[model samples]
Target: MPYINIKITREGVTAEQKARLIAGATQLLVDVLGKNPATTVVVIDEVDTDNWGIAGEQVTRRRERGR
Candidate 1:
């Protein structure tokens, strides 16, 4: 079994987009690793910008500075 974890900022991602991400990850394992789709697991984690950070700053602050 293959376990894939995906994390993204919780910025109003649509259900369809999440579904596509899961499907794409599963398909990638199936295509590249020859893993069974039924045995593949994909988890999507949506985190608040404040909880996610980059370059010594929170994502929320980064976005604010960019704007």
Candidate 2:
């Protein structure tokens, strides 16, 4: 079995976005990686601003500054 994990830190992640991302990722593994979707597992983790950093700064701070 194939296990896939996708971690993203951002606001406003819709159901459609998750579906598309999973589909695309699965397709990539199936087509490019020569894996089977039936045996592949995809997991998405949505993290808060504090869990992610950008430019050596925390995203929560940027959002506070409206940047």
Best candidate per TM-score, number? 1
lDDT of 1 by residue, 1-67 (tens): 9999999999999999999999999999999989999989999999999999888889999889883
Cα deviation of 53 in candidate 1 (Å)? 0.6
lDDT of each: 0.95, 0.90
- Give one digit per residue, the lDDT tens place, for model 2 in 1-67: 6788999986899999999998998899988879979988899999999989999999999889998
Relative to the unseen true structure, what is the Cα RMSD of model 1? Answer: 1.0
For model 2, where is the 10-residue window of minimal lDDT? Answer: 1-10
Clash count per candidate: 0, 0
Report the C-alpha displacement of residue 56, candidate 1, in angstroms. 0.4
